[model samples]
Target: METRELRYFVAVAEELHFGRAAQRLGMAQPPLSRAIQRLERRLGVTLFDRTNRTIALTEAGTVLLREGRAALDAVAAAERRTRRAVPGRPGLVLVTKAGATGELLSKLLDAYAAEPGAATVDVLLCQPGEQERLLRDGRADVALLHRPFDSTTGLEAEELYTEGQAAVLPAAHPLTDRPHLRTADVAALPGLPLPRWPGPGGTYPPGPGPEVRDHAQLLQLIALGRASAILPDSCRSHLDPGLAAVPVLDAAPVTTVIAWPPHSRSLPLAALIRIALRLGSEHGSAALVRGG
Candidate 1:
């Protein structure tokens, strides 16, 4: 009946565990259970068969679950359309990664703020999976990410620039003596402390070697001879004292890209894209000057 009840039912149906679903929704299990019960009573059909050991969706429940998701999507799309049509306000939310994209966004926001009739920009620092989820759910209007994206459908992507990955090492490490260190050299090092690999959403992947949450922690770890990390050139700007960033040998450069739901090509988004292109051009010019 109510949207909230339908949402709870759908979450439980998808997760198949009331406890886990409640946790994901940030609510108590009892309340989620109550909402599901209310929905079931209204529909006169049991959506789930639950016992102490297991939870499974019934046939009727499956049909309703599919329909419920579609209905929710339609409602969300409608809301996005209505919001965009409102006067004197920017209706888009931009989500991007924390390092270079974050910096680029700040510059764009400054320009936008100076313009008349600029839309509101909500710049969210999102994890890899979060961007996909936000775009899919109509919660985010645009996203910028380091490639490779897991999925391409329902979105449009533009390449911004290629970024080299650097191996961040301790100052006292032998590799620091060189201007650049190869990936093989790193992999061959005995007892080298390597930072944990980042997952699809830019968070440290599960399981561990060494995990550093920020540039300072990364520097501290490397300085103590505890570990090394491979990071993009953009991240180099964040390096702390006593850390050396050497180029990784023979590694493929990562690409930075801007992505958005295919339908979000508003005037503001176009302007932002132009700004990004200009910044990329400027960076290229600077790189050429340094090389020369």
Candidate 2:
């Protein structure tokens, strides 16, 4: 099916209402209905179950919606990559969560620049939960993603390194003196609710914690005794003077991975990835030493 039809179907599938989907698409309902009907006939399957008051996706509709979204993302990536391929402007755009990757990013960029014929690399710092969307939609060529935190679905990725977690708290907090703390110990701390980060849709989940956009803001909140956080142990290197981090012995280890679109064949991206893997390996021992 054409991308237009796929887009219309996806809208209807997501909204579960033809009229609403048409409005979202900025058109009237009649043609939208016709388009969906034609698509269903061409595909030889019913795409939706419709009634007087509501509509629902059929089993086949569910499958198409999943595959269609991927197809649309691939098309968008192709268009963006092509537009960016201007002559004599060769470069790679790397995205990662701000205030998170820290020294590892610095080392990777420095190492990549030394390679022969290395293209210029531009770094884009974004909030957490945004790197995957940027990479998938072609706003970014590659990204640094942490597993169990960032979703890497529909992307090619390689593990860089893994590090244990820690609970970052106010310097004067009673728990700061402990050699280490468990997740439960951190969770039970009164009046220091963990900061709630915005999800992919940019909305905060329901919680008592203050809404946070990035690590910098979260750290500030922690320093003021308004919040606490469980973050990768590497965060200790960047903690401010008013804050301290105690290892969370039972927290999950976070794995940092370098990811890109699966269909990408860019030589510069390959070179960057190679350097990142090497640096990650070289520094794995050091990261472990620091975490300990």
Candidate 3:
């Protein structure tokens, strides 16, 4: 199917309304509806179950939606990468959530730059959950992502290291007196709700807490006693005096990974990945020694 048709199908499938989808696509509803109908006829599958009052995706529609989104992302990535591939476009763009992977990122850059012929590396710090989209859309050449919190679907990645989680709270809060806390204890804290970070579409999930845009904002909120968060223990190194982190025993351990497009062929990017893997392995070994 044409990318245009797939685009239409995805918009409709996501919105679940033809009129809204047409508006989103900046086209007339009649033509948009016809396009979907034509696509359905050509594919010999009823993509949607539409009635007088409501419309929903059939099983095939669900599959197409998922696959179509991926296809569209691939096409966009190809276009962007091609445009940037012209002569003199050197260096790599590395993206990650702002205020995260602090020490590791600095050390990686230092190590890579010390190599004989490392290219310039541009760091693109973004809000939470934006790395995958930036990487897929060719706006970034690599990413440092945390698993279970960040999705690494469709990207090739190397496991950096796994770390436990800790709950960040106001330094003066009663919970800070405890040596450690369980996830349930953090959740059951009175008056302090976990802040909601934006998902892929840049929308916050339904929650009682304030909506946070980045680690800095979330930290500020915690300092003010308005919110709390369970983040990787590595964050403890960066917490301010006004806040404290207690190990959360039952939260899922977060694994850090270095990720890039599966099809990348740049020698510099490969060298960078090698350094990241080496550093990650060494860090894990050091941790094991300390634990032992």
Residues 1-69, candidate 1: write the lDDT tens digits: 666776888899889999999998999999888888878888899889989999999999999899889
Winner on lDDT (1 vs 3): 3
Deviation in Å, model 1, residue 14 alpha carbon: 3.5
The number of the candidate with the highest lDDT is 2
Error of 2 at 289 (Å): 4.0
Q: Give the worst 10-residue stretch by lDDT in candidate 2.
A: 283-292
Candidate 3 C-alpha lDDT tens digits along 42-157: 99999999999789999999999999998998899889878766666668899998998898999999999999978899999999888878998889899999999888888899
Better of 1 and 2 by TM-score: 2
Q: Write the per-residue lDDT of candidate 2 for residues 102-165, one digit (tens) a residue.
A: 8999999998999999999999999998888999889899999999988888789999999889
Q: By TM-score, how accurate is candidate 1?
A: 0.69
Span of ten consecutive residues with least summed lDDT in model 3: 81-90
Tell me how candidate 2 scores on lDDT: 0.92
Q: What is the lDDT of residue 276 in candidate 3?
A: 98
* TM per candidate: 0.69, 0.93, 0.86
Candidates in order have lDDT scores of: 0.73, 0.92, 0.91
